[model samples]
Target: MHNSIERTPIRAHLTDHMVIVNAQAVETGPTRRPAAVLIWSTTDQKIAFSDPKGNLLFEGKAALVAPEVIRRLRTTDSTFFSLNFEPGNRHFLPLSRLVARQDFMPLKFDRFSELSDELQSRFELADYKGIEELSDELALTLLPRTNAKHLRDERIDLLLPLLESNQPPELNSLAQMLHLSKDRLSHLFADDIGMPLRSYVLWRRYRRALLALQSGEKIATVAHRVGFYDHAQMSRTFLTLFGYSPSILKCPKFIRISGIQSN
Candidate 1:
């Protein structure tokens, strides 16, 4: 059994809500709805991704994944690069805006030339510091309309840290923290971040669970630690997000380019 394969975490520049990862998965199997700007280094990669209703969202090399859906990869052993935007993350609005329209959007390869080049040239040869520097550079380049200040949302800025806690704040409690009604907060969250509060919360929990499992924590322990009801609950979330059981994280080939600290 391949258990908890290790790879150095890819360090990214600190930005509220945006996530960047440069990872390589070797036959790592299918992944769930990843909310990020996913650029795979493969030409004409056949992908069959869909919403919960099974509606086809994309079939291409690069696609922006919105939170809370299920998608399948057609291949493994490929370089996977992504920049995910969360609430309080105003840096990648162009990418976020695309995810807002639907579950996923097919992107042209040229959209990520610098990131792709860096991944190819330095990903294998670079040391941790070099990867960290490259990741910072990549994050800077991914900002949309770099000259304009990101559209800041104080509500989300306050909300992100809460979402990272072991027990996510209740929506009503979160709204109270932001001084808004739950309904109003939900609408604004969807409007600004392009996904509902519940979905984002689920995705955040799912991410924590993945990292924990990868670190070799037992499934039950990870589930409880990350605020899932149980191992089953965590597994369900994984199934919902990755279209596979959480055990896939246990795969011998599983390789992670860790995103920023969430635990």
Candidate 2:
């Protein structure tokens, strides 16, 4: 018998604060995830997660992982679904509450199992809106009473737009505009956004590049337009944010993206 795993196209639904991904037999090496994520196996098959030293961490049907956790995922032949929530997402605070500031937390998969078939069918049919609705339902099921208030800070709100431009303002200038010292601004941003200001800026640039790529622009053009130093730099950033290289886009047959937009 052949020992190779048969891989399928990766289907993903992307929004400013959330991303839903479905894939089969995909594996990732130890890497620090930039956002909190909920993962479950669609086939009722077991999935394994390990630390950087390859020490067994968890082997189960579902898991909730805190952001910045360095771990490896071993899916083997199982189909899996994942929900990634950005730090600033409204659901993030609630979800983080579940993790209790830990690296991993096992989750009951009863709800996920019930909806797995329908979610898989929707992805195959390219029903993005349906996918979004169903994913939201799953999220609510996992985190009940999730109608939490959104994080708001006028200073961070003002800083967000400045970071969108190809030539974002320096941190010193941004603090000046906010009428605060740079140290104060940095602390405020971290407290409000749940991430460092510099990291968020880089994530914004990476997101802009993804949107440009979705429009079928050349890598070099997208890199330049998104404020990356060059193609090589952009590729490196892509790999850092995503476990895979940006070259994976070359195989459009193996990738499907929907509802991707700028923040």
Estimate TM-scores for all models.
0.69, 0.85
Q: Under the 3 Å rule for N, CA and C atoms, how many clashes does model 1 have?
A: 3
Give me the runs in candidate 1 sitting further than 4 Å from their true place: 1-34, 42-70, 76-80, 86-88, 91-93, 99-117, 120-122, 125-150
Residue-level lDDT tens digits of model 2 in 197-262: 888888878767766676677888888988888999988887667665566643455566666564
Angstrom error of the Cα, residue 203, model 1: value is 1.4
After TM-score superposition, the amount by which residue 201's alpha carbon in candidate 2 deviates from its true location, in angstroms, is 1.1
- Which 10 successive residues of model 1 have the least lDDT summed? 7-16
Best by TM-score: 2
